[model samples]
Target: MANTTSAKKATRKIARKTAINKARRTRVRGCLRKVEEAIAAADQAAASEALRIAQSELMRAVSKGVFHKNTASRKVSRLSKRIKALSA
Candidate 1:
């Protein structure tokens, strides 16, 4: 119920941004899932590779404002720790 023209335009802009951010979030989740799957399967090499890709996707999301930098960093750190533990 946006009566003002500017308000209508803002609503449209918000919808567009929502769609884009949703896609980005989905992509990031997919990457994280891949890493987790690799880890669960205990495949060190695959986990490492997946983590590499996930790390980049996470940072990309952070840059796009889909995720906070610290959140992404924490995810990357935890994944790295798990991957390293596989070596032991």
Candidate 2:
């Protein structure tokens, strides 16, 4: 659907970026799932570690423009609260 030369090149770049962004999102989701599972299993230590990892991944997503900064912050806040509640 791209007609101009630069448009065609931009389209290609967009496709590549889409793959990278998708992978980043998948990894973030996996990290979050790990945290959730650890919390569900009542493993406080593991849940804390997993939360750290998931938070890092979410921040990375924000830096890469895959997520908004506020969105990542909100998720991190909620996840941290859940992890804290597991201990309390």
Candidate 3:
């Protein structure tokens, strides 16, 4: 239990932030899943488009601090590489 008023306020704030972060994380995961599904289907065009949207969502999550910058970059790199491989 929070002993001070400040502690209670901080707890509330943390809860709110946690909920927001969870939502952002869920959305990012959904975007990644979409890209993977497109790639698995072997549809280069759809994969490319999904990758584009996923990249944007990933970077946005990074900007919001939901994901580390390097993590987002790595994901985008791997996805792009896969998409390129599909074309080749």
Query: Number of the top candidate by TM-score?
Result: 1
After TM-score superposition, the amount by which residue 45's alpha carbon in candidate 3 deviates from its true location, in angstroms, is 0.8
Model 2 root-mean-square deviation: 0.8
Point out where model 1 deviates above 4 Å.
Answer: none
Task: Name the TM-score of candidate 2.
Answer: 0.94
Candidate 2 stretches with Cα past 4 Å from truth are none
Judge candidate 3 against the unseen true structure and give its global Cα lDDT, from 0 to 1: 0.93
Best by lDDT: 1
Cα lDDT tens digits, model 2, 1-88, are: 9999999999999999999999999999999999989989989999999998999999999999999999999988998888889877
Candidate 3, 1-88: lDDT as tens digits: 9999999999999999999999989998999999999989999999999989988988998999999999999999999999899888
1 versus 3: better TM-score goes to: 1
Q: Using TM-score as the measure, what is the rank order of every candidate, best first?
A: 1, 3, 2
> TM-scores across all candidates?
0.98, 0.94, 0.97
Which stretches of model 3 miss by more than 4 angstroms?
A: none
Question: What lDDT tens digits, residue by residue, belong to model 1 across residues 1-88?
Answer: 9999999999999999999999999999999999999999999999999999999999999999999999999999999999999889
Q: In angstroms, how far off is 68's CA in candidate 2? A: 0.6
Cα distance off (Å), candidate 3, residue 65:
0.9
